[model samples]
Target: MDLLKFITAGSVDDGKSTLIGRLLYDTDSILDDQLEAIQRANRKNDDGTLDLAILTDGLKAEREQGITIDVAYKYFHTEKRKFIIADTPGHIQYTRNMVTGASNADLAIILIDARKGVVEQTRRHSFLVSLLAIPNILVCINKMDMVDYDKAVFDKIQADYERLTKNMNSTQVDYIPVSALKGDNIAMRSPNTPWYDGKPLLEFLETVEVNQQPEVQQARFPVQWVIRPQTAELPDYRGYAGRVVGGSFAVGDRIVALPSGVASTITRIELASESLTTAESGASVIIHLADDIDISRGDMLVKAGEQPVLSQSFESDICWMDTRPLDVNQTYLLQQHGKTTKVKIQDIVYRIDIETLERTASDGFGLNDIGRIQFKCADPLAFDRYAFNKANGGAILIDTRNNLTVAALMISEPVDH
Candidate 1:
């Protein structure tokens, strides 16, 4: 089964967690013991249903507050697909946590209460998921049970959402009216809304197409480590080890290693003990080159004619996670493609209004703030624009004193020289 990584986001009480729990429950992905434990807790929703939200509110603090604070990840597999679901907090204060969970997701399940229509959080999360460039969005209008599964409510909310997101970056948007708590239109279509017609959540998830696979795009092999089994027999063997992030690499293909820009041909590729002729993206393997040049971590291997942007300065879109606002004078460590280098902020272009997607002049960013900023690295780094290749274009900022990751960066176009 193919794997799909998605996230759930909405306002608190919008049923994000409940939607996840229902998807798991209806798919029979939950263990009997797990279900029994939830039942044993004796917590019941106001509608007299077993509190399925407890299935994902694993943290006691979360259960106590009836709110999710940290990103809760759940894994399950059905016959059609394997899934990684990130249930993120919906509170504005926990916005950083939501960004962290959404960073690597292929799709987002942005929830809305049928009774509440589109609230402020609906706008906030919509802007965020769009900023993150999450390819697909399943905007699940949840809590239809509370609204009596009214088609008018669903249609109005869906219309409002479409108008609001008309300018957002989300490429594909799908809507499903569901009652997550009551399992209505989740696994099977609910008959309560005779005027509505759409596939259940599970059915859509099982078949949604996401073309974010790296192997099928341009090839990128960022060097992570150098492997030299210094044993007696393998003294001459040297292999570059890393995960293939894009395209495919095959034996005898002409390749170039960047920063140094050395040209070489692949001698062999090995995944574990098995030797292979080609390695696709997402594969972790040791690549032996025909030429033993000075290859090291941070170097990128690409097809001879294919090269990523190599520069010391570039434009970056950042979602700051630090509580202490950004300091213009501070130097940070830019970690990208498994390599770290000293970096400093060159300029802050503008601050984006997460709620309205507005661009305005800004001094700096604070916690959960999003901005377009320029950065200068100590060394030239090879990268593609995040829109072109997500694997090579992503980076993080870390404080040198404490090594705390303070920002997530998505490299956009390079700054004009």
Candidate 2:
């Protein structure tokens, strides 16, 4: 079975955790002892039933406060497919946590409390789903039981959400009415929602196509290490080792080393002792080139004539993840794949108002603030526009003093200055 990675996000009390727990409970994905432990905790809902949210809100503080703070990851598999679910925090202060979880997800489940309808976190998380370029979105209109499973309520919320996301041309959106507490429309369709004709949440997830479009694919190999052993037994053995982060690499294919701009053809591809003719995305292999070139760590290899934008400055959208405010005067480190270069914040164009989705003038960004900015790298970097190819376009900014990652960046386009 293929794997699907997804994230759940919404406002606090939107039932994100409960929905995940219900899926695990109804699907029998939870262990007997684990089920018994939550039961033993005796955390019950308003109606005196066991609180399923506790299954993911495992932190004592979270259970006591009834809110998720950190990102909680859960894994389970059914006969049809395997899943990795990230239950991210919903509070405004924890928006950075949501960004971290959604970074690698193929799908995003933005839960809307049927009782409350569309709200701030709805827009915030939706904006993030678009900004991160998540391919698929399944908006789970949860707590349908609270609204008596009325079809009107589902339709109203669905319409409002559609209007909010109509501009998201690249993302595919779908909706389902669900009462997570009652195990309806999650693992299976509920009789309560008889008017709904769509497949249940689990079934939809199993069948959804999250594969990347092959037409946009391009090869990107960031050389993490260059191996050279001048032993008498095997002289002049040189190989570049790294994981192929995008597209594929085949032997005899013409390639170029970026930043160096040297061209060569792939002589061989090896995985440990085995030789391979080709290596696809996500494969870690040592590659040999036809000609010895001055390649080093932090250099990238790409297919000839399909080179990424080479520039020392670029525009980007960033989420400030640190407590300290962004300072344009101070120098930071921009780490893109294997390359780490000194970068300075050239300017902060604007800060996004999460609730209204407006770009407002801002002096600086604080924790969890999302905005548009420009970066000046010390050396020319090879990167694609984030919307075009995420594998080679995403990067992170690290604080020079503490070496802590301070921001998540999505490259927009290369800039001249």
Candidate 3:
């Protein structure tokens, strides 16, 4: 079965954690021992009620504060498909955690409290999802029980949310009414919501076409490691092992190595126990070139004509992950694919306001700030626009002094009309 990776985002106390816990419980995905543990915790904290939120509050700090501070991942599978949930924190202080979780998500679930309707955090998360270019979005209006399960209330919230989404550039958005605390309209549809005819949350998740996004337009394989046997039995064995970031490559396809500008044909593709003729995106394979021409870990292989732009300077939108403010003159190490190079921030173009999506010219960025800026690298880096290919277009900045990942970057060029 195919796997679906999704991230959950919402305001604090919006029932994001409870919704996930209920989904696991209703779908029989939780083990008996795990359920017993949760029951024990619930009984201990009981004031005549079961704290279903305890199911996902795994961290001690989270359990004590009743708020998620970091991304909590959970795995479960139904008959139709498997799921990996990235339960991200909803607080403003933890916005960096949300960005990290949503970076690899194929879908985003933005929940809203029915009683509170659309709040500031709802807009903030929706904007962040749009900024990240998450392909699919599901707007779940939670806590319908608090509103007496009224269809009118659900309709009003839906309308308001639709209006709010008008400013977003999302391709697909869905709305569903649910009560996570009571397990209503989660895995199974609720009879109480007779007026609501949409499928349950789990049903939608199982059937949604999460992989319908466009395929890579260009093939890119960055060499992560090189395998060479020294023994006589396999003395001449040589292969470049890496993951295919974009497009597909076949055994006989002609390819070129970047930076060196050398051409070679793919002789074979090997996996753990078998050899394949072709490799597609997300596949890890060992590629044997027809002629070995000094390829290393940082080198990239691409089709001769479909090569990415090579440059030492480029502009990108960055999400600062560190607590210290970014210094424009400071130098950092940039890691792309398996390649690393020293780079200096040349200029601070503008900082984006998360709430309003407006650009403000600034000298530096603070923690969790998103902005577009230019960088000057020590050597030419091969990349594509983030909108075209996520893997090739994305990079991470690391502080050389502390070896800390400080920011996530998306490469882009100024549009020419």
Candidate 4:
């Protein structure tokens, strides 16, 4: 079965985790012991109804505070497909956690409380979904039960959201009115909303293709390890081991080693010790180059005609994730597509006002602040624009001093010289 990686995000108490719990519950994907544990937590619920949120709010602090403190991942599958669900936090302070969950997601389900409509967090998340370039967006207008399952309410909120996301870069935007608590429009249709005719969320998830318009990125692989198992019988076993970050690699394909400008053909491809003619994106495989070029960890292999941008400095949009203010004088480490190098923040171009979609002068990015910044890497970075491919363009900034991640970097369009 194919797999889908998705994340759920929204404001605190907007039922993001509960929606996931309801989906898992109605799908019968929960185990007996897990249900028993939830049943025990249900006894503490204010109302007689069970607290389905406990299923995903697994952290003790989350359960105690009734909030999601970190990104909790859950896995389940139906006969149709498998899924990896990332339940992200909703609070503004936890924006870094949300970004981490969204970096590699194929789709996102942004929950909107029916009574509250679109709030600040909703806009921030929608913008991030665009920045992260998540293709499919399912805006779940949740808590319909509290809103009396009113179609008018859903319609109005949908209109407001459309206006808010008019400038976003998301490819597809869809909506559903759901009552995560009552299980309406979750796994099964609800007659309460006779005017609405969309399929249930789970049904949509099962049927819809998350990568609706797949970006055909050029084959790019960053060597993670050099495998040279010197078995006396078959000695020359120098293979470059890494996961395919973009496109596909196949035997006999003309490939180029980046930063060094060495060219060669793929001599062999191995997956789990089995030889293969081709390895697609996200595949973990060992590749052997014909020429035995000077390739090593952090060096990328790509199609000769479709090489990624190689530059020592590039501009990008950055979400400041550190607790302290960004320090321009401090050098940070930039890691992208398995390659790491020391980088310096050269300039802060501007900060974005997500609410107004305005760019204003800014010295440095503060926590949760999105800004355009220039970075000079110690070595050449092979990257694509985030809009072209997320895995190709997404990177993180690490503080060399403490080795803590301080920012999420999404490379913007490269300027032509």
The per-residue C-alpha lDDT of model 2 at residue 353 equals 87
The Cα RMSD in angstroms, rounded to one decimal, for candidate 3 relative to the true structure is: 2.9
Give the number of the best model, judged by TM-score.
2
**lDDT by residue for model 1 (1-417), tens:** 789999888988888767878888877889999999998999998868888888866654654776545678899888989999987777776777887888889899999988889988888788778878888989999889888888888899999999878868746889998888888888888888777778889999989987553334678999999988899999898999999999899999999999898899999999988999999889999999998899888888999998888999999888898778899899999999778999988899998876667788998899888879998889998999987777788899999878988988889978756
Ranking by TM-score: 2, 1, 4, 3
Residue pairs in clash, model 1 = none
lDDT for each residue of candidate 3 in 277-382, tens digit (9 for 90 to 100): 8999899999999997999898899998999988889999888988888877789999999999999988888987766667788988998788798898887788
TM-score of each: 0.93, 0.94, 0.91, 0.92
In candidate 1, position 332 carries an lDDT of 94
lDDT of 2 by residue, 318-356 (tens): 999898888888899999988999999888888988766
Candidate maximizing lDDT:
2
Give the TM-score (vs. native) of candidate 2.
0.94
User: Which pairs of residues have clashing backbones in candidate 4?
Assistant: none
